[model samples]
Target: MFSKVLVANRGEIACRVIRTLHRMGITAVAIYSEADAGAKHVALADEALCVGPAAANKSYLNIEAVIEAASSTGAEAIHPGYGFLSENVEFARACTAAGITFIGPAEAALEIMGDKIRSKNHVAQAGVPLVEGISEPGLSDEQLISAGEKMTFPVLIKPSAGGGGKGMHVVERPEDLGETLATARRVAKASFGDDTLFIEQLIRSPRHIEVQVLADAQGNVIHLGERECSLQRRHQKVIEEAPSALLDEATRARIGQAACDTARSVDYLGAGTVEFLVSDEEPEKFYFMEMNTRLQVEHPVTEEVTGIDLVEQQIRIAAGQPLSLRQEDITLTGHSVEARIYAEDAEARFMPSAGTIIGLQEPTGEGIRVDSGMLPGLVIGTDYDPMLAKVIATGADRDQALSRLHQALGGTIIHGLTTNTAYLQQLVADEDVRRGQMDTTMIERKLPDLQFPTPQQHHAVAAGLLAAQLKGLHPETAGNQEEGPTGWQPDGWRHSGAQNPVFAVSWQPPGTTAEPQEFDVIVDGSSRLIPVGEGRYLLRSSATATEVHLTAGEGSRQTGTEIWISSGDFTGALSVLDQEAATHRQLAEIEAELTEALPEVTAPMPGTVVAVGVESGHEVNAGDVLVVIEAMKMEHRLAAPTAGTARINVALGDQVSLGQVLAAVEAEQAENTESKD
Candidate 1:
């Protein structure tokens, strides 16, 4: 085994790799950009180095810097975790040239499969079932159009490079083809630096299934079953599970063999995934999508179900050893499901949320696994992916696993930053998801009803109110309440007895533009309070206090109330903003102002503009890649649309402000464009 390994990546994946290395008694070296200096992965590594500035172009993507860091640290191998240099063929070759092992597939394999068109062709030649499309290279736009005509309307324009939905566009008709092509080309050039693209027939409502395979240098290979990754948003997976519920034993075996065939055809090494598009409309029909020649982000579900440490296996194989376990040794013990918890607001368009995490509660039980990068004090920054953690649950069967997942989500609590926690809870219990009838279009189909949180919102409001009340009674405020300028507190002197002080406070629930809920709180100056809102407030003083005295307000309801507290240590109540509002108060007010002021342009996520497609005064349509933001060695283009607008913003080479206005697009009408990246 290697004594030390350099992890050439950042965020949760880096932290995840280092954890496995530590368990295997190997020193882990972490590389970070300026923005990642204080990141979770950096603090977790045994050795750390700053490669360059915040921008990934000058840091994470800097091949020379990474190599030097590895050499200086005397690392015997470099583990390019997922994104960044994970799939970069040149980086793999560089490591080999430097006599350092790369813990992934060989550079030759990457060179062939990294290009989408070539990879598809290779798989097709191996007799794998491929979807109807052109996998050949060197096709002109006119030729592409001809191929599209053959495929008919609703064709998929995919970049013949990288994955993760980047540079992929879906055109429903001919009139949208040109713009989609231009956008795809620009995105392809930015993301992969290869403007090459291919056309495919769109598989409506397809379940994105993938087979996990591992191979050693000696050509010994085995398949570890399949993972269903149909629950997605913005082309990125949100939820994943192992032993796809939709596939039968025969179909599963066939898919597994096809995956092995594809791996052997490419001389694949280490752990990789062969993705397939399984149609929801047809149970037995599955088509080859592409092969990811590195560890997948949703690998935990596979690990949980198979009892395998994929990272440890990667290292063992890279050391020129065979896979530790044979196909027969692999067994699917139970059902497992994982949800990718992101720091984004699910109700408010899933906007990436950045803020300090005031409190955190991770679920722990018989079958729960939480792979996280966040703690109580960690601050989520916009310079990286908005993902906070991957919450996994396992059980003896599918229904049990789903039940456990729902419980885990409920037990898990996060404060400070907005999250998709409420949405996740709903998704697990959702009829389609629970029935295992999930597909990529599942979320979209249930979007209208799933767009808001009702019960969770009620609980959140109750928690917020409780938190506000708790803050009001804090020692600091309790000691100096009468001296405040607002004169909001009652005038009082020293009280000798245990007195319950009542105060009236009002708050508007989230998403409600008008009318704030008014409540009266009676504090006994102890640890708890009785809150009365639109319902009667009850106080429990004994174990059998069901019929305790109830104080009712006008229009009070018979339903009892639940509360939430903001403090991480506190249980049963939500955390409400404790600090009194200054001239401006309430989260809604702050959000409203931010929306009115901030521009619509997609901001950079710790990346550089590799290419600028437009200039001042250029009229651009929606979904146009105005500027490409490259980060962690990967490039992402910021596009326009959802409305069309003329450029009235700054020029290229300008160090743009965070959330600055790049251009203005006055929406001709409100419309939703599904994300391509």
Candidate 2:
């Protein structure tokens, strides 16, 4: 066993690794970027080092920095947790040359399995079933176009390097293949530093199933049960579980063995995952997608079911230990599910959100486990992945697991920024998802039907009462204002005089584009914010009282003219639209034709411009993607909102902020009217 191991990564994975190392009595070393100096992972480690700047490439992905951090700390081994340098071939070789053990597969395994094209081909040569496609290396655009013409329509384009579904595109139309290829190549270069790509047959109604395999340097390889990762958006997994509901015992054994065989072909070491595209129509048939050379983000679910510590296995394997468990010894005890909670607003097209954490309440109980990266005062930014935590639950059956996960989600609360908590809760209860009748594109199809309602009347009542309590306006407060107008003042709120205070607010739920609906709650002293116990509150609605919050977020306004409220399963941003400065802004908008006059489309989140689809003065109609910006490893396209001559404001490689103007569409009528003027 390693006396000390340096974690060459940040966030929850690093913290998770440190916990295991502590459990095994191994000294843990952690490396962090400047942005993560105060991160939870750094605090959890025995020793820590600042690697580089906030940029991932400079810090977590910097091979030299990570290696030096390990060497200086006298670390015997380095653990690249899931992302950054986890599957990096050069990083592995660097560790070996430096006499520091890499707690993962060797260079051979990383080089072969890290590249999707090579892995697909290598596994195929080993008699592993391959998905039908043109996977020849270094295929040019013309070659892919030529191949597309001969093959069926709707082929999938995947970058040869990198995982987590980045740079993967599905070209549905024959005409769009050329343009789509260019975008994919660009993303591939920017993300993986590899522009090489391959085409694959787009399997419809396919279920994503993957088997977790553990191996050692002695060529002993054993497989754990499979995980279902079909709940996805833009090919990025949102929910994952072990012991796939879609697979039968017979198919499960076959897939598990295939995974073991795939590992054996490369003489794989440590923990690796073999992904397969299983057909929903025929569960028996499965095709190899690609192998993840390092630990997977969804690995916790597998550990829960098999009662095996994969990270421990990786450490042991890297130390040249033989496999501890045989294939027969691995028995999945129960069903486990994991939901990835991201710093994103689910109502706002799932846009990446950034803010300082003012409050937080993670779920905990008999069957629930939370792998969290966030802490109170932790600032979430767009520099790294937006995933803040993962909530996993286990039970005797899938239904129980889903139910526990759902309840756990309702109990979760994070303040100061929006998250996808409510969205995940609704997903677990989805009919299609509950019945195991789902596919890769299930999220997109069912997203429209998922109800992420805006702040209801009860939510307004809760916020109103909470505000009164904080302002000493609640009857429970000992302040003496017997009658007449009283002054109410809260954080970032101006003093307001009223006999009966009225809070005029507008709330926008995540995942919805609808304009904030204005809601007014009158605090006539009938309503009072009272603690019912366990961080929960009760809001009075006339004669009736509604219990709100299993946990609460920043229930009051602070920096911005908005109050974030967590009610039941939902957390919403309530803008103080009718307050002091807000009133003046609304009046100004009405005086000028501001709502209709605004022609510029701005970025919803901060990021670098990746693509410019239109040049200045180019004619475009509504809904044409004019600019693509990459933030938090996700690309968002800014579109022309009206028919006009497009006037782009920002260029490729420009860093933009939230609401920064990207482009302006000069309507023909507006141009004509201006000319006449």
Candidate 3:
């Protein structure tokens, strides 16, 4: 075991590695950028170092800076927790040359498996079954189209140099192939700095099953069963489970052996994952996808089922330790499921939502485990991945595991920022998901039907009443108070006895387009509304009396009052809008509407403009790509809204703000001229 190890990553994965290192009695060192200086991982490390600025290229991806930090801190090994430099072969080689262990596979294995095209070729040569498609790299757009024509329609364009579903596109129609390929290439270049791509046959109703393999330098390799990562959105895995319900005992053994053989062929060391695309129609047939050369994001599920700590194994293997157990020694136990909780709006097409996490309540129980790196005051910016945490649940069987996962999601609370918690709950409860009948396209197919829980009338009333009560207690407050009528007393009462002290407020739930529900809270001093201990409240209505757990705190005037209300399984935040604040917000919305009525392409999020496809006076059709903005390590293309001539405003490499105009489009008009003689 290493005496000291440095984690060359950030966020939850870094924190996870640090915890394992502490368990091994090793000093844990953390490297951070300016944005993550106050992150939870930094606070948990034994020693911390600031590598560079907030941009990942300057910090986490800076191989020299990371090596220097490890050297300065006396770290004997460096753990590149998945993503960033984890798959960078040069970084791994640098660590080895620097006399420090990389805590992962050998650089040779990384180089072979990092490129999807090359990895497929190697795996095929090793007698592993591969997906039927073109594995050749550097095919031009026309060549790619030609290859796809031979493979038939509905082909997938995938970046050969990177993983994590960053630069992948599915083209169902023949005519859309050209545009999709161009966009995929651009995203691949921006993300991996290599636009090398390959065309693959899009399997219909396929289950994504990956086998976790662990190896040591002594040439001993074993498999840790399999995980089902079929539930996905935008080609990104959303939910994952271990001991796939789809595979029978015979099939499981065959696939597990194949994964082990794949690893052995490369003399793979440390932890790696071999992915496969299993056809739902033909469960016996599985095709090799690619191998993740490092630890995976959904590795917790495999850990729960196999009773193995993969990180500990990686460190021991990197230290030249032999395998403690053989393939026969490993046994699969209970079923487990993991849900990735991200700071994104599922309803808004999973757009990343970044802001301070005002409040958090993680689920706790015997079968539940939460690996998180977020605190109450953590500021989630657009500079990194939006994943907040991962919640994993285990049970005796698949049904029990599914039930526990649903319960855990309901109990998890993330206040202030929009999250996919509600969407996750809906997904796990779906009939197909409950029956273990899901595929890679399930989430995208069912996204339109996933509904957020609607706020009940009583909940809205409770929030309004709570807001009004707090305002009365803290009268003369300027920042969050709503402007009341003239001469109204600070005690929440009017001088005129004839008028009832009726307060009108509106409550808006998170990530919904529905109009805010209005409530009239009549407080004549006769009604009793008292706050109990620990965010609980007792309210007396004209019809009945009820006790509600509610917490109210001041927020910016623009955000209204942040109120957390718990009503059974539905616990969430509500923005209570008083009359004055509501009117001001309405006016702001009107202004935004007026501005949007113009034909202009605006930045949806704050990011750098990577490319501008159209120039001034360039004619464009609807859905033509105009500008590409990169935010949170993802590229978003701004498309033309309608047929028009363009007027470009922003240039390449320009940093843009949210809603900043990047270009304007004028409606194309018919050219008129005098009749020629």
Candidate 4:
């Protein structure tokens, strides 16, 4: 075991590694960028070092800085926790040169698997069933088109380097090949600094299943069971589970052996994941996608189901130890599911939402584990991925696990920014996902229904509201209002007497729209009307300056003076006002637009247009991506009206303002556009 180890990463994964290191009695060292100086990972580590600027190239990705940090700290090993330099071959080689162990596959294997085209070829030669496609060298568009004729339609064009759905594209037909290839090439060059590409048959209705494997330098390798990662958006996994519902015992064994074989073939060391694309057809067929040469982001679910800590195994293997548990020793336990809570808006095309986390209330109980990156008052800037945490739950079976997950999500509260918590909760209870009838395309296919309101939603909302109100009244509720809001001020109402109040407030239950909901509450023995909007209410009582939190006709529960607030049950907060003179100047310009007339079209947010799908005088249907804007490292498609003739005022490279008229339609059709908004 390493006496001192350097975690060459930041955020949640870094914090996760530090916890494990602490448990194992190892001193954990952390490296941080300028922007991450106050990050949670830095505070959690035993020792921290400031490496470079906020930019990744200057900090997290800087090999020299990382090596220097380890050397200065006298660390024995460096754990590259996913992303950043985790899969970088040169970084691993540098660590080796520094006489420091890299807790992953060797530099040589990293080199081989780092390149997708080469890795796919090596695995194919190892007799691993690979996705059918073209791997010919230096294939041009003409040659690719010719090759496509032999295979099938809906081919995937992918970069030969790196993964994570970056530099990947799918063309539905031959006519879309040119644009798809060009786009893939551009993204590939940008993401991997390599423009090399390959073609593969796009398997429809595919389920992403990955096998976790551990190997030692002594030529011994063992396979952990599989994890189902079918719930994804833009190739990024949103939810994952262990012991896939689709894989039968025999198929699971076969895939496990194949995964182990591939690991041994590469002389793989430490922890790695072998990913596969399993078809949803009868007698599902599995094909290899690629091998992730480092620990995976969704590895916790696998650990929960198998009762194995993969990080511990990785450490043991890195220390030149053999496998502690053979294949038989590993027993698959009850079902486990993990939901990745991200700072994003599901209703808004899943765009990343950046703001200060005013409040955070993580779920706690048996069979639940939360690996988080952010805490209260943490600003979720646009500088990195928007993932906030991974919440995992285990149960006796799938239904039990799913039910626990629902409770966990409901209990998990994140305020101050929009998150996918509600979206994930809806997904877990989804009929298709519940029945285990899931595929890669299932999310996209059922997205509309999942996002929209259901018949039972109102009941759930009412119950949640009542529960929140009742919880607020508890003297020691799960959520603490004493935890001050991040940047907002909470009125000192408790100190103030219940007299000369400006607002009268009370709780209300489910009632008719015209009539008030039933709430038997009295402050100073006076009846008050509790305003209920939709299923919840925000109450301000005249007896006190601070807003009283009441649910289901409960007593007043105080809240902290902060812009951000999150309690497991009662999740609410106030927004901080920047009252400085400089702040007023910043809001001056925006105030003019607010008072002026509305424009013909508007730019949703600051972004670069990846495509101008509509041209001047072009007819477009509703929900058509008039322009695709890339913001916060994610794409946001600006759609058209139900019916409109687009008269584009902005060109492809032009930058448009928020609420600026990017296009206009005829007067009669313009009303339709306005109505949609």
Candidate 5:
């Protein structure tokens, strides 16, 4: 085994690799950008090095800087963990030249399979089943149109140089082909620096299946069953599982052998995944999609079911070891499912959310595992992927695994930032998902019907009572005799009345536009507000009594006292208004003025404006695209809410903050009157 290995990545995958290296008795070295100075991966590594700035292009993708870091830290091998430079052939060759082993396939294999067009051709020649499409390179717009016509309607135009759903478009009509192709080419050039694209037949309702293959230097290759990755959004996988519920024993063997054949055709080495698009209607028929020439993000599901440490195998193979186990020796033990927990809002088209994690509680028990790089104080930024962690559950059967996954997600708490935790819970319990009847389009189809649990009245009342008690304990206003256990006044009664002090409070549920619920809570005595711990309280009322987990954060100047409350499965933020503070009245006046202002298009999140589709005096209709903002490597198009004349404020390439007005739209009465005259 190698003495030291450098992880050439960041976030959860880097931490995962470091953990396995430590188990193998190898010191792990970590590389980080400026944004990840205090990241979990950096702290977990035996040695750390700063590569470059926060941008991936300047840091993680800088091949020379990574190589220098590895060499300077005396790392014997470099493990490119699934992103950035992981699939770059040049990085592999550079590591080889510098006498450091690359823990992946050979550079030759990467070159052959890295290009979609080239890989399709190679696999087709080797008799692997392929989807009908045009793989010829350097096709012009006219040529692409002609090819699309030949393939019939509903064809997919994809950039041949990159993956992750970037620069990919689907056109269902011939009339829209030209514009779609132009957009695809432009995005492809910008994203991958290659305008080369190919047309493929769009398989309706296909199931994504991939076989994990490991090859040693001695030419021994074996497959580790398969994983179902059909649950996706915008071509990126959301949930994945091992020992696919769809595949039978016979079909599993066939697909496994086909994947191995594809790998052997190029003398592949280390860890690689062979992806395929299996028709949902015809499970026996499968078409090769592409081969990822490095470790996969969903490899843990396979690891859990097969009881094999894939990272350990990769290192062993990189050290010129032969295959430790043959194909017959490998076995799939149970069902395992993994849910990718991202810092994103599922209700808002999965828009990426960035903020500091105020409090975190991970689930732990039998059949549950969490692989994460996040800590309580970590800041999720927009410079990298929004995935915070992955929660995986294993069981003897699929039903049990699904149940455990649902429970695990409920027990997991990620506070202060918006996340997909509630959405994940709904997905697991979805009727079709629970029955193992799902396809690539199921999530998008069912997204509109999925509902998040609403916060109960008792929960809100608890928050209100807690907030009122906390407010009275303020040393600045209350008698400074040192607050009581419940953070109430020393006398435990307001001087205003002996009956008790009743205050109106409001609570806004997470991820909703509904009006904030209002209720009145009376703090009569210590029995109603009991302090359990430093940041926990029990609120008792006539209707109900509940335990509330409260965490006090820095007070927002606009919202006053901000407290995060978690009761049962519902979590929300409560802003307390004493109705007595002078500041509250001032805030009310400011809010009233803002609410009466002219209608304007504002940025929903912090991002950079990539495109502005309107200008001053330009007339736009409702639902027309007004501006495109890029955040966390994804593009979101903001549309005009109503028909009007647009007065643009933000230009292309300008940074915008949440709720910052980008444009104002007024009724186009002037234009209409002029036209009539």
Candidate 6:
């Protein structure tokens, strides 16, 4: 066994590998960027190294830096935990040249499986079933159109070199195929550095099932059942489960054997997952999609059910140890379900959310597990993937596992930043999910029907009360501040004759830009924060008692003292605004009625401007692309609001804050009038 291993990744997966290393008595070395100096993984490791700056390319994906860090730390092997450099074939070769073991598949496997088009061709030769399409490389656009004319109308256009739903598009009409191919080529070229194109038949209502396979250097291989990853949004998995409800024993054995064959075909070593697109109607028919040559983000569910440590297996394989367990020894004991928690707003098309985690609550009980790198004051910036953690649950059956997962999600709390916790809870209980009638399109299809909780008067009251307590009153205000400003105590003050303080506060629900509703909370002199440990508080009143979770944060706003609160399924921010701030916002009702056309183009979220389509004072149509901002590894193109002159305010490479005006459209009417004059 290797005495020391370096984790060339950050966040939750890095922490996960370090934990396994410590359990095995192996020293764990962690590498981090400047932004992650205080990260949880760094604190968990025996040694740490600073790779580079916050930018992923200069840091986590820096091959030379990672190799140097491993050498300096005296690590025998390096683990690339998903994302970043996990699937980089060049990084693996670098480690080998540096005499540091790469704890993943061999170079041959990486070369063959790294490219989707190549993997499909390789696996098909191994007798693995494949979806029908034009998967050959080096085909021109005109040739592809000519070839696609005879195939089905709706087809999938994807890059040959990447996964994770990036650079993949579905074309429904034959006429739209050429246009989509151009867009796909651009995206694929930008994301994967290879514009290699391929076509695949778009399987309708397919269930995504993948088999986890492990092999040693001696060519010994075994399968550990299949995981259902059909719950997805935009091709990224949101939830996963082990021992899929769709597969019977016969089909399970078949798919498992097919996965083993894929591993053998590559002369594979270490842990890998072979993904397949299974027909929802015909459970017996499954087609190979692609192979992931590293640990998957959804690997926890397989670990929970199989009672095996995948990381341990990876290390052992890399150390040239033979397979310790056979296929007969592997058994799926129980059902496990996992929900991915991301720093994103589910209500607003799941846009990435960023900020400091002021408070957190991870559920723990029978059959519940949490794999996370979340710590108080952890700054979730827009530099990398948005997934923060995962919540997994196991049970004797699928129903119980689903039920436990739902309960666990309900108890999960993250304040000071928006998350998909509430949405995950709702998804677990969704009818399609519960009945096992799910497809990859289920989440997007059912998103409109999922009812998220909105803030009410009680929520407002709880937040207001907490805000008042969090910001205590001054001694003078405690006595009588009849003439003083109300916000000296944050919109709360003791009346000259009254015994208690009154908090005139406003509550804003999560994921909204609307004005907060006004609420006056009268806190009795006796009303105080009870000693409730772990973020929960019960506010006692004459009428009723309500419990809310809260955290005092340096608010995003300039003037308000923001108190983040959570009660039941709803989370919101309570702002204590002085009279001037509140009245000014509410008084601007007429301005809200102005035309959205020729509107100010503001940054929807904080990000860096990657592209500027037009220079200042250029004429553009309503749909012309104005600027492109990249955040959380996704590019958002801002377009003109209406036909007008583009007045650009920001240049390329400029860092922008949310709501910062990037440009504005000067209406054509103004241009016409100026021309006439």
**By the TM-score metric, which is better: model 2 or model 5?**
2
TM-score of each: 0.79, 0.93, 0.90, 0.76, 0.91, 0.92
Query: Could you tell me the TM-score of candidate 4?
Result: 0.76
**Best model per TM-score:** 2
The deviation in Å at residue 594 for candidate 1 is 19
Candidate 2 stretches with Cα past 4 Å from truth are 476-498, 509-513, 532-535, 550-561, 577-582, 591-598, 670-677
Error of 4 at 320 (Å): 1.4
Candidate 6, lDDT over the whole model: 0.84
lDDT by residue for model 3 (241-286), tens = 9999999999999999999999988889999999999999888889
lDDT accuracy of residue 214 in candidate 5: 96
Q: What is each predicted model's overall lDDT from 0 to 1?
A: 0.72, 0.84, 0.84, 0.72, 0.83, 0.84
Model 2 backbone overlap count: 6
The C-alpha stretches of model 3 lying farther than 4 A from their native spots are 474-487, 491-495, 498-504, 507-517, 524-559, 562-573, 582-601, 617-624, 640-647, 664-677
**lDDT at 180, model 6:** 78
lDDT of candidate 1 over 1-677, digit per residue (tens): 89999999987789899999999999999999987777888999999999999656688888999999999999999999886788989998899899999999998789888888888887777777888887679888877877677676778888887676665777999777876787678667755668899988877789999999999999988999999999987567888998899999898888888889889988899999999999887868889899999999889989999989999999999998887688889889899999989877666566566666665767899899988877767767655667788889999998899899988887677766567877888889898888898788778677677644332332333333343354454322443455344334532333342223443334333322456445444344333234443222332332321111111111111112223232221222222322233212455567777775423665533334556767655667767767765443334467775445555465554555445566666555556888888
What is candidate 2's TM-score against the reference? 0.93
> Model 6 compared with the native: what TM-score?
0.92
What C-alpha lDDT does candidate 3 achieve relative to the native structure? 0.84
lDDT digits (tens) for residues 1-677 of candidate 4: 78999999988899998998999999999999888888999999999999999767788888999999999999999999988889988898899899999998987788778777788888888877788889876788778877888878888888887566665777888888986786777666545667788999887788999999988878888888999999887678888999899999899998999899988887899999999998877535788898999988899988998888888888888988888788888888899999999877676567666666655668899899999998767767655667889999999999999999999998787766668887888899888889999888778777776543221222222233333333232212322245344322222233422221111112221111233122222122122224443222333334532222222221222311122223232333331211232244346747876784422556654445566787878877667667765545555556675566777777765645444566655433333444553
- The digit string of per-residue lDDT tens for model 5 on 368-431 reads 9999989878988877778899999999999999899999998777777778988998889888
In candidate 3, which residue pairs get closer than 3 Å at backbone N, Cα or C atoms, i.e. clash? Answer: none
lDDT of 2: 0.84
